[model samples]
Target: MVCRSVLLRSVAAAVLVASVSACSLWGGRAAKPVAAELGPNVAVLGVRQAWTARVGKIELPLELHVNGNVVTLASSDGVVAALDAKTGSDVWRAMLGEPLSTGPGSDGKTAAVVTRANALVALESGREKWRQQLPAQVFTPPLVAGGRVFVLSSDRSVAAYDGATGRRLWTQQRPGEPLVLRQAGVLLALGDTLVVGLSGRMVGMNPNTGVTQWELPLASPRGTNDVERLVELVGRVSRVGDSVCARAFQASVGCVNTARGAVAWTQVASGSEGIHGDDRAVFGTEGNGVVTAWSRVDGSRLWSMDRYKHRKLTAPLLLGRSIVFGDDSGTVHLVSRDDGAPLNRISTDGSGIAAAPAVASDTLVVVSRNGSVYGFRPD
Candidate 1:
């Protein structure tokens, strides 16, 4: 169980989960091994904490919705609050009084939160608007867009509901995998298309009709057993210009030509966390914690940094000229974006950052497992 728990977090870092064993899973392949050692961390980048707002205990990833200067976040205790991005002061707060299964989602208008009890609660202007019971537990954060809220549930289903009325608009489901990730696929909205990362591919769906515009194959299920073929798409997908990049939980990472609905390139590296890239290069942190940079055009390897090898890390985020990511020890590392080189670091709650640090307007925001949300600036 320890090995399963450690390796499941090896790269993907499942949301707010702590225990996993073969007995807990259907007959599946055993997880890959990981060393339980961590190297000494020395601070290089100096960061000053600007402000912090009290959020109740949070175990799952912190879902942050940043629109202009307003940032919204939800705690596991079901308190959703909107804060002033620059000041980190609470502008409004709403409590659902339920154990949150997923985090908060909003469009700077209607805010959404899900309960482990399989309920969806919507709030407007810090007031309860509506609540809807679902068929299964939600695994991904609610995505509010197009007058609808989108969420992926534990039963391999995707559903849309009216953001205002909690009315189910449409529901779609794919066949369940023999072995699937405990986490749900990430969802993105571009125009009228809802781009979703699924079991083994990425699909662009029509938000209005639930029809897929196109599907891009990311990985094919393979293995002697179920666990070997658990090819869930793990985290958020990156979109720069007309290209969209995604990583398969234990398979590979690659980018696609969104305009042409064609794959640009793929390389053989296993990771669950998605890549961070701009127009020229795409960056990834592998399952072994080795970070690499590749040519976004040709998928040719440019450089690789293994300083954090074997250390559990959260998803990497490219911030300005640096790549910033946090480790299991709650230490944040900054590496040069031009080439992967150690830059600076800072320590937080020491309970770890369960999610990728988000950029809210001019501030970098992180939610620690200890229920502390800090707003900081990187120099």
Candidate 2:
């Protein structure tokens, strides 16, 4: 009886979190969570500020892509920038127009950005190379591989374009869901196969021919409510040796074999954001703000930290001896990577973190929701 009661309470809590959604759940469209009180800082954790820059206004949970030593960043205001990873200096900045919805996808040689006008813009060095129109609005960043750019739009289509000339290559699509979240998914190039996340599964494609290689189901839609069925792969993935690790929006987290398209293991964890890892373990935050770590080899639980319950974690990052995470309260927490205990923290701007911090070599790049970008290092 006690076990059943606990299980019922857990399911109820998950439903409550899902119903709140990303936006305003009281009425019309979805909305982001309102700014929460900063509460109290983590006192001290030995994290030192390396540099800070204002890389335009960050309204969405857009992630920063790092290629070479230049990190590509995009803002909702149509501003895209390439910053030096070591110094945090702007290598180049291009203003597209009034509003930019997604991207700043880069593979060092080329960069791609998407606008709110349903367009794909490519840049070389700092110059505009070409721009192409899409059939629908885009919610994820473009994936540049080989000589092609792979884009998954709101119309539930995965299409490829020539990065050099912006010509349409080939397109494959799935049925669009009634409701979708605007979060980005992992789009990576694995040898000859291209991995793109659709509504609830991961589809591997041929970059040259746009052919379906393999389809691996990450999360199946199995909820009674409209909000509960809104599941998709969120954030970026962790590539450990031969395994690809990822998480579903509010479902399970697992690691898959990239070459054979086989499911290794999955644990019932719920998080809207994604995950991060090292050579040994995978770390992610669940919907209730519990940071859990699992072994990369056998998916064994290492430890879990739950002090920040319900704080709305962005994503968990591993930095030196600390497992770092930024919360909706505009504070960054650092916990022991060895034991998962709270260590220290610092505040950005009291507006919450925008996305998972991008790791460039030894430095960590972070952006807050209120347009503040910061660089930090273990001190």
lDDT of 2: 0.76
Model 2 Cα displacement at 140 (Å)?
A: 0.8
What's the lDDT for residue 317 in model 1?
A: 85
**Residue-wise C-alpha lDDT for candidate 2, range 141-238, written one tens digit per residue:** 88877878888776667888998999998888777344456657668888778888877787788887778888888788887855557777776788
In the predicted model 1, the residue pairs found to clash are 45-344, 45-345
Question: What C-alpha lDDT, on a 0 to 100 scale, does residue 59 get in candidate 1?
Answer: 76
What TM-score would candidate 1 get against the native? 0.88
- For model 2, the run of ten residues with the poorest summed lDDT: 5-14
Error of 2 at 81 (Å): 0.8
Deviation (Å) of 184 in candidate 1? 4.4
Candidate 2 ranges beyond 4 A from true positions = 1-45
